[model samples]
Target: MTAPHPQAARHVRAVAVQPHWSAQDFVTAAAFRRWMRAQLDMARPHLNENGVNLVVLTELNGLPLVMRGGAWALRLRTFERVALALFLARLPRTLPILLRERVSPVRALQLADIDANTDLYLTTCRDLAREYGVYLCCGSAPTPRYERRSARLCRQPGLLTNQTVLLDPNGDLIGVTDKVHLTPDEEAGGVDLTPGALGDLRVFPTPAGDLGVAISLDAFRADVIGTLAAQGCTVLLQPDANGAPWTAKEGLPPDPANLRDQPEAWLESSWQVTAQRQIPYAVNPMVVGNLLDLTFDGQSAITGPAEEAPAPRSYVLTAPRPGFLALAPWVTSGEPPALREAGRHRAALSGHPMENQYREATLHADLTLPPATRPAPPRTPHEDALHALLRGEARAARPGRWPWVLAALPLALLARPLWRRRRA
Candidate 1:
């Protein structure tokens, strides 16, 4: 049998989902099977595909087990507003909330008694990275802990969630950043869950290529995106939930319905497209759902650069499961696309039957670099007007160069009689 393609052979697609979860204190297997089926159905399109898709779901970061005659069962949870909540979320009262500002040592001792999933979640993510080329991170920075046991929680290996850049066979960055921001629920019980820490912008050295990565949801902010691009980041892989943060209306403040593109959470939870040179910029979002659990929403999507740029091409894509959005190698894409000033620049044309009939670019001495180190900025109003005048003068001086051959080519191909002249 043929060996599988080497790792990082091509683009990588991945996804993550956070199901709206209720506290569960039961160990019944039946309820778990129902939940598992629903999530699997939601991800079937991604799962059924031939290639590996990195699916990240909020349930067990790594699926647990199956029961009975080839039946599947799993327990899924939203990152606990409290860790104990992961298994006991349905009961909010049972969830730990501080009634008093301070607690006795006895209570503190009781808090420490709960089981922890820090290493479990962390290990699952690492395994997924190596196994699926898809990584799903459920829960967030804080997993909820009594204020006192917080230290122990951070001390555990799981307190810190990360996104390792994908590496090529040679250990180069495949282009994507690991999760940097930890949500409150993820860090609820312990650990420092806030966004923006040291090493937020980390570079991974891999044989595929070096990678520059950023994690927070806001890491895709206009400024942040620009900064990362400038810093030599090739891929921006970000994972987010799909429950809220969707758009419900247009041209208004946080659309009452849509949570994704609203104004309120623009900083932490939003995606937008910006073009620098008209190369297509697009933003695509993926929402994962549980067919077994219809109430469950989806997660993990790629919000590509907007498409209104110069090239007039689509920019967003998603697998939403072991899903990924990728740009083809620059060679296939032809020229280095950039955010160009809108004008008369031609859009990219591809693989037409007569594509060769068109012209290819030829180098010219006049194309030499300018004296200034920086590229020339767009022309100012005065410069623009002057350039327009010069263009008009040059056109007038040389008379138009109409392509008479274009007009005759159609006549020769059709070979139809001259309209009224031939009729007469």
Candidate 2:
């Protein structure tokens, strides 16, 4: 809870900004700062003009910031491009490396760098929220953190967690929601991730009513949406960083593809949840980028509630290129008049367990805040070179050390005859 409930005539303006990236974009932290600042600046005028009170950016939008390490990572070249792509493609294939203790140092160094950059990202978003005077759901990122010991089985003493953070206007931290469900590939990839529970609803109170967030594929789960709706949440924000091509069938209802690149299935999970909940839903997905050969598409949009009169579903605004912004004025209290239609009533009566489960967030304490800001230092060439050396060392330490084993073969053969003759 972070905003005061505005009475009649006041509206909550929500904006979803799509972020783009290329190989050149991840050169340095300053470059990332400039890129992020530019996007925020572009949305600022629109936010001000629209009298926006809440702003949301896409998931893992801050990932490029994590690339602000090492000359090897910064300098772009054809061979280096292929090498780096191969390296990234193999990052998730850590199971064998983990068992062999090969990539631990590399991941340790990289995780530290990513964690530092994530801190920078959080601080920047907090400042933006303060500057724009808007409640911001900053974004999500994968970060390694220490977990408290409990009776539960230890999956790995400590591991990385993909988390989404929230900040109120005036730059105060609110709630942090972790991804509950992980892809099977991620599980097998050796980066042990802790999955969140469905019963632990991360619902927060907002001036715009009760607001909830579901990261990436989690939004597609009917139970997740149902639980939130049952908790009386009206606004659902689903932030995504989908590298897969949009395989949603044209002129067909959308379905959730779980962030996998499925060719034949329509990604209808998020849309179906919105359609069922009859609530305002915003989907802000990453767009237009390549990390090596992995490409991301832009399809940011805000879908209105299901309406019987106009059509079977609510209005949808999708952004294709140069990014997109979907803005709409919202009343904090009461259901929209469009939901009063016969079709909506029928849908509601059809028994959705989440519909009207709890009271509104207005009844809770307002998420008041105080003033504070944190700024990060510039990336230096010395630092980059040092990190590059660390990366080199990591590459050399990979498992299946056939190079060392082969080099030792000649020395062992030469020594074997000498030891035998001496013994004879």
Candidate 3:
């Protein structure tokens, strides 16, 4: 069967694939190396003859497609890989095979040198992209670079420029596109990346299918996604980087979840336009830290139509282990308590959007799916009073508190006076 356009394939599906890595996989040398190899072997079968896999690789947006694959087997320290050979005597047969994934004349870096490691990291990306048929997103350094100090440096005009293209099986590109949006002081690696101008947009032909690509983060905003949707792009690849240091969700002042919200928000809009247009979206996974762990997360995904509705089942794979996640398109049974709390924070609640819907996407993008943005939490009477007292501009649609305050004020005042008179 042939799709009229990528947009024509809205009856697509969204699927999530990820590898579960045990913590022990990190500490033990022999055991960890063996596990990494097993992971690669597991993933290799899904590859095409050209090394491409059905997985959808992307970020916010990008123009063309690329392919790659590789691996790195390093211990916590230099001595670990060179002399100590900590757990080698006990490693399984799988260990040697895993090292082949990464053809390394290897280089090592500590956590402090993540930035310095950029050149080698990107070279690794280029190599993997060439070897694999699929666009292999590589390197554990400055990923999702959108949040990096270097990215913030891009804001100064003439400092940063980008383009987009669509590549074919022969590695010949069919289309070239540019970005449309750029914002100011966008947070990156504890700093901000500047903005730039719009780029080209159009379609290209491919042997497997026609592809439409959007190349950069800023370029793939709401307007651009809408435009691409209008033109009909079946498969989209967005390779973006955060460039920020890595840490768990609890560490940062502004949660990485907030940074994550940008793409998820766009996908809500883009996915709808994509579904309506019958196209699928391949969003590359964003990284949390620059540590060289190929632990793919839930970010990378595939979206298309389903027998019933378009949901996660369409997803193909997720990053393996100590990394991100990929989830199949499916709705949650109910909203979580946190979402319920957030809804109350909104100026208004209900009738919103999600990764799958328009309303769930409302101002807060991440909370769109599952437990639907919790309806504004039930107001506590004390909070109700505090709000009324603070409303030098408070316009709580709930007016009951006003009369309650008024009725109680007189009683409170009179009771005080009466008690004073009795005492006198």
Give per-model CA RMSD. 28.3, 16.9, 24.7
Q: How close is candidate 3 to the true structure, as a TM-score?
A: 0.38
Error of 2 at 162 (Å): 1.6
* Number of backbone collisions per candidate: 65, 10, 84
Candidate 2, 66-179: lDDT as tens digits: 345444643443322433343343344322333343334223323434435655666667667777787777767664432212211112223555667666776665566667
The candidate with the higher lDDT, 2 or 3, is 2
lDDT of each: 0.27, 0.45, 0.28
Better of 1 and 3 by lDDT: 3
Better of 1 and 2 by lDDT: 2
The per-residue C-alpha lDDT of model 2 at residue 210 equals: 54
lDDT computed for candidate 2: 0.45
lDDT of 3 by residue, 78-130 (tens): 22232112222212211221132221111111111222222233333333334
Clashes of 3: 84
Q: Which window of 10 residues has the lowest lDDT sum in candidate 1?
A: 361-370
Candidate 2 residue runs with Cα over 4 Å from true position: 1-10, 48-52, 74-110, 146-157, 190-192, 247-267, 307-424
The deviation in Å at residue 309 for candidate 2 is: 10
